[model samples]
Target chain A: MSDYKLDYLDQLESESIHIMREVAGQFERPALLFSGGKDSIVLVHLALKAFRPGKFPFPLVHIDTGHNFKEALEYRDNLAEEIGERLIVRNVEDTIKLKHLAEPKGKFASRNALQTYTLLDTIEEFKFDACIGGARRDEEKARAKERIFSVRDEFGQWNPKLQRPELWSIYNGKIDKGENVRVFPISNWTELDIWNYIKRENIKLPSIYFAHKREVIEHEGQFVAMSKFVLIEPTDKISVRKVRYRTVGDMTCTAAVESNATKIDDIINEIIATKTSERGETRIDDQVSEAAMEDRKKNGYF
Target chain B: MDILRFITAGSVDDGKSTLIGRLLYDSKSIMIDHLEAIERQTKNRDDGEIDLALLTDGLRAEREQGITIDVAYKYFSTPKRKFIIADAPGHIQYTRNMVTGASNSELIIILVDARHGVIEQTRRHSIIASLLNIPHVVVAVNKMDLVEYSEEVYNNILKDYDSLAGQLGLKNVTYIPISALNGDNIVDASQLLPWYKGDTLLNYLENVSLADDINLTNARFPVQYVIRPQTEQLHDYRGYAGKVISGIYKVGDAVTILPSGESSRISMIELGGKKVKEAFAPQSVVIHLRHDVDVSRGDVIVKDEDIPLIEQQIEVLLCWMDNKPLIAGNKYLLQINSSRVRCVVKTIDYKLNVNTLEKDLSPDKAGLNDIIRATIKTAQPIAYDSYQKLRVNGGAILIDETSNVTVGACMIQ
Candidate 1:
């Protein structure tokens, strides 16, 4: 309803809002996954717009890897406090110690994969029937095959061979006890689209996303932030340079690119000529194998 | 940028995946890191030349098994337009997956191997594109290099596919001959084919006119959920929230709630919390009515004059998806738009041979990937338009209630 039909971004926003409202209406207990990333930040804005004046029917779930950047954690806390919603954070650190899981060793090791255990544990503890995520098909090959209302089994596993046929906008959220749906409201959005939207909507993100001088070291052909979680090897080269992260995650794996994109518009422009993919260049974990993402998704490692 | 959604379907070894990969590559959409990853993967699998086919097959099983088992969505953009590509499996057993991809596409790309010319998969995909009411069709004569880029081979494919396209009622058919592997006439015009004068696949996709594809004559909106925020500032608010599937709706229009046959004026038109004067097709809106007429979810609203048929029994063309055979007298949960009803299959008129377009009139059952015509009886009357007339309002899916699996896709005939 407007003077003219919605352009691409508005249409995408409207569609995303419709999806969030659907998830809120259909699922008995749902939570929005907050990673302090740009996509999840937009998701929070959309969910608020979908149901405002009244508190959201669900809480915000953040699976804390505990290896996060300080700025990202600060932003997550501030956004949750400003919105006045419940933020339930379960840590991978706790899960690793309690479950007696071995931490990934060496310089390139990331707590990213270990997050799945804590995430699944949180879902089971709260019996959350649906967990909303900011995953987009454009992010990876395996994500492209995901349905909006993706179903996970009792063991928190995804069966890609038996995915249900989703027709039009009708999402069937029907699942039995012990099973939950991992809903993605922005499944169709591309990285460029997300950046363009963040610029247009003036959506805020963590300071790490914009360029600034940071202490970093080279790892697997990319510049990664120097952190306590990452054991700096004797052979590694340390440097202080102006850089920004395309994707923010655990500092051990998420790499930073040399950039002076101090603002959202600058970031959007930088993406236009970006030669490397975010998950490919930054997410060293997904680059473990060609089917690394597929294996992770199948093993409930979203 | 304008959005274009298209589907690519063809059997294995027909270069369907290779064509999609070519589009992504030549458009400069594939990033360097992704290319390196694929390069490493190709070495591991000894795929020879950095196999582009591996890029589109998403699942680990699909990669290990070397086949596409389900539909996967891909996104890319040129400076001119944005594209959403639905890559569907082409095996005969995965017709339901093809249908799922075609259900939302405005155009369909059916790749035909140049050596094979017009084959069974070519005909089946063409029929599916036509049945799904996809406006545009592209018959890409792929692997032209294997055929030595022969003009005669391309022309013969055009001639063979012309009759099939005519038979299937595919009005907007375009033929392009190209080698997806060597990157000919996909994103770049081919120097290999000097005799051909046609837009590259990427150029055509960006330039295609799809504004007129929407069904604007029949206004239909099925309420998915009711938005009622009972709060202090805005104490009274009752809005029927749904997407406008077709046509246009405006404030103060004489809209009627279907099944109940109650009439009311549209008091306001709300899109994403703001009141607007009018709303058009495909935009999600929360509409307010002048009177409270006992409206609820599953009630479709339309212009009072443009009423669709309200009936209990519907004849549908169904593509069975589940392993269990679809036989007459089996019950299912029938869902169309936002409406759901308990329904039973009344009778199977005939089973379809998708490859031959033949009908078996005396078929007792239809199993996985079988397309058949059957009559379905709903527990209550439902309002719908014919599939050919209005796709969004007409098409539905049959879900197995107990298992919560979507077993069949139905197009009301």
Candidate 2:
């Protein structure tokens, strides 16, 4: 009798697949916002499980910040090519140049804010009615309040106060023209759940997730990887450390944790033993303010 | 391990957030950095005790006002089960939030401050739990330490709530006395309340019987998308992709597609892109029919032996969510499962007074957070079971076409 009962991971997978299918059924011009992160990698896997045997209903869209890690960019291109799906790449660098956007000047000058411009422009370019993202509610506080089918206004601004009451499994994807919905299929999953599901499904991720020796500079206590995107000052303490990324964001803002967890099991064990939240340890952009994510979300950033 | 999704119902002062915080903290789900952040916020307080309530206040407005205005999802896990807590604000004005949270939950924990037991909010929360047809109910009598863990007080509250539960037809009710502030009877059994012989809250939650909650007798599968490869290799393949909302599906079983009444045999079932003989409830799978039927999205595939009710007019106990008042004869979109159709509010019958369990027989209009019984006429027939029978198929939502907002949640009667 217990055989009929699904494993928790299986349940999560089913729920996510259901959501992905809902997006496919509801919207006309939809796109999956792939970031080449483990979460997005899982999204692609779920999308395959959702609409495969048939070609994907929508294309894989990536708003490349240009400051992205080389390995992630290569992995993104390969995954799309291997899956035989359409890939749409919009550059934040081009958006910055075309829109005459002033780049933020700092030691770790993140193009995170500028990425929204490219994303909105791409949404306008393709007129994507629904954009599926890999955002999990467990990632941050503001994210916890977001609906599964989050509606964004004409400018892609997220009004947290005006969110629709998402009831049951019934999602209201009905929106007017110029208004888009951001569908997060993995909203219920947590960071640990993501890792566990990845391990269970045996999904492939970029090599940065595994432990590797890399040159990093210590800022506060977090190890920021030495990339051309960041400004390396003389006062910075540089060292070669065995580090891995807990989360994959732009190289300028995402920090690495010192670890020897090369295997998935070891990584899971380390996550269980760690005391810091995923954002607290890796996302330098979130450290600017307590409401940083909230502000970013309000400003049309995914 | 399985997952338990539950809702905690209480007001700002009910220590609802504190209880959730205690659950996460004791279960080792709260990380050190999150705790440190809370500590930083708790620094200026004269009491010196960390306000666990601060943990769930996510939005800036919520943090500044010190009130939860929206439903916030919090996760924690013990070795036994993973729990998703939908921490909803319990004020009367936030009934929409609670209804939204309760829609997906199998269990609801109605918090009762020991000092004030069986209050209006308690009854209101219970009414919602009953209306939503939540499978399990845990009446957590919190603030036991403040009440001196008195057996008489707990008994009195239980007596009062029992009659209310009876009136509301709430089944599977369990009671526990605890103090969220002192962490009594939350994760560990309370040393203070020795008179209570029932299992602690966490113990009961970890072992609750959720197997029966899934309706296996009646199979329901609503197609969300149609898969057609249209390639040289599998050019003839056509599949109906959907989640089995309930029951089981097997190869060679007779099936009927609703609204079209097209009958076909299940020739094949695919689970996770692999061929499978059978699939059960809550599983996402693609079903291939032996015959090519005219099937598309918004179609329900069901067994011939267990046909659901198909009707255009439905009586619904609706929770008006939007600020705009719901007037009789106004048009909206009624969506049941994957199927949606134009619906009109034929009549706003009566508003249910959540606090008193009394119905206002002549309510003119339904406003925000107001629960009312109404007759809705849809443009097309909807196949569904009663809300009390199968929650998966019985629940629906009313979408406002002009604003494109989900304005009402309808529990189809």
Candidate 3:
């Protein structure tokens, strides 16, 4: 007989898988949000476990911000192809061209906030009732209050006060027409949990997550990678440094940390010793205020 | 690493939030920005020190009112274990929030004010925790400094709590005397309690064994969905995708599909794209059957040798969560595992008095946030074990058919 004890990781995995199945069984049409980030990659891997020996019941969807890392985009496409799954990519540039979004001033301004418009538009376009993302509670204070099955109104706004009560493993995914549920299977998994899972499962991720030499400029106490969309000031000096991204987002907003944790095990160890949070180091938007993520989430930014 | 999820419950002034804040702060879990934000908000307060309560009181309305109105989850990890602290409200009106927070917790920390030992609210919280089957209870006697760290006051509270614990049938009870404001015996043991030789709060949380919390005797697997990948690459693959609710399931174990009376053997257990020898409760995996049967979602897979009672009527302990009272003869959806069946309340056996631990048999209607024992009749025969036997299969939620909101949670008796 196989000994089956409830390890912390196993328990977390079970809960996440239960959530994923709930998403598939409850929603009319759901899509897995693939961002080529470590969290999203882990979500895809869990989805695969959710319906094993069978193709994923839901399609994989990616909201491209146009300023994505080329390596990340390449990795995303290759992963989708390798898994033989349908990949749907919606671009914010198209949304901007279509006059759905206003262009911001300065080249370094982020399309991170503007992606919400395109995301809602894609949900409307595809009539997806549920969009499963890899949002964790430990990421921010506001996110800490989020339900596993977060319900969004017709306008795609999240009212934390009015969320449905999720008890036990039972998730209420019922929603009115035009209203959708934003399902977060890994809502309970912390950054350390994700790193530990990735290390244990040997889940493949984009190369950007590992330490590599890249051209970067220090901006507002962050090492902003040198990209075509980034506007470098005359006083800013470009330097080459070995850095790894704790998070993957739009190149204009995502920052890198100086680290030598090239391997997954080393990265896990680094995360254990690192005092700064994944978002604390990489997400420039959250550095603004305590309620920044909360405000964005209210505005339908996943 | 061990994972401990505990709920902190007490009356409004019992320093529940302060205790949680102290734990988070002393554990070094609070970041610089979070600390700064708390500092800026509490600048005008009496003490120049940051009011740690402000960290968990997330809502603007709650912050302005200086009270916790909802459940706020706080996470912190020591070198020993990771902890998920559910900071539940203490107000009598928000009993639903307390129930929600304590539902999934393995431990309940009932905070008692040493100056006011074992108040009505403490009894209320302890009763609810016991009702929810929280295996462990930690009675944290707060504000020892106010009592001059008097051993007499601490012992008085402990004696009262022990009596209450005996009444509630709580076996594993630990008493720790500390002051949340002074930061004593929380993360670190205080010198004031040198005579006290019990484990510190963090130490107790780190070493608590939660492996037995999940029932592993009766195997219950509710099929969430049937996976039939009709593609040519893997044409003949038919797997039942769902989480193992209880017990260990091996590849060659003889299994029975409930409601269908079909028998089969597990051909394989696949988890995360890898074939495993066996699967158990809470692990989401796909199980391959030796025989192709007409199985779908809501159907349960159990051990062929040991089958559960398949019945249309069940008596359950229900906790009403909706604002509307639970009226008999009203149709509601009772969802267990993947099975959703229309059920009606046959009778309200008794309403539980949370504070006094008394059963009011005269109440015909279960009000909002009331824990009541009721008998329910379902439209279809559902497979289930007693709550004491299997929490996953025995536990269910009542959904209001009209609003589609989960109005209550039911545990089969």
Q: What residue runs in model 3 are displaced by over 4 Å at the alpha carbon? A: B64-69
Q: What is candidate 2's lDDT per residue for B180-280, written digit by digit as tens?
A: 99999998998898999999899999999999988888999999999999999998999999999999999999999998888999999999899999999
State what share of the real interface contacts each candidate retains.
0.57, 0.88, 0.57
Cα lDDT of model 2 by residue, A1-302, tens digit: 67799989999999999999999999999999999999999999999999888999999999999999898999999999999999999999999899899998999999999999999999999999999999998889999999999999989999888999999899899999999999999998988999999998899999999999999999999999998888988899999999999999999999999999999999999998988999999999998988999999999988
Candidate with the larger TM-score of 2 and 3:
2
Query: Which scores better on lDDT, 1 or 3?
Result: 1
**Residue lDDT tens for model 1, A136-173:** 99999789898989999977788888789987677888
TM-score of each predicted structure versus truth: 0.95, 0.99, 0.95
lDDT of 3 at B274: 85
* Winner of 1 and 2 under DockQ: 2
Chain A of candidate 2 gets a TM-score of: 0.99
Cα RMSD (Å) between model 1 and the true structure? Answer: 2.2
Clashing residue pairs in candidate 3 are none
* Predicted candidate 3 versus true structure: per-residue lDDT over A174-193, tens digit per residue: 67789999999888788989
TM-score of chain B of each: 0.97, 0.99, 0.97
Query: Over the stretch B1-413, how does candidate 1's per-residue lDDT look in tens digits?
Result: 67888999886598887888888888889988778777877886654787887667677787678777789999888887889999998888789899999998889999999999888888888878887888899989999999888999999999999999888878889988889889999988989999899998888998988777776779998886677768777777887877788889999999889888899999998876678998887787888899978888789999988999999999999989899999899999998877889999999999989998999999999999899999999998999998888888889999898899999988898
After superposition, candidate 2 runs with Cα above 4 Å error? none
Error of 3 at A109 (Å): 1.4
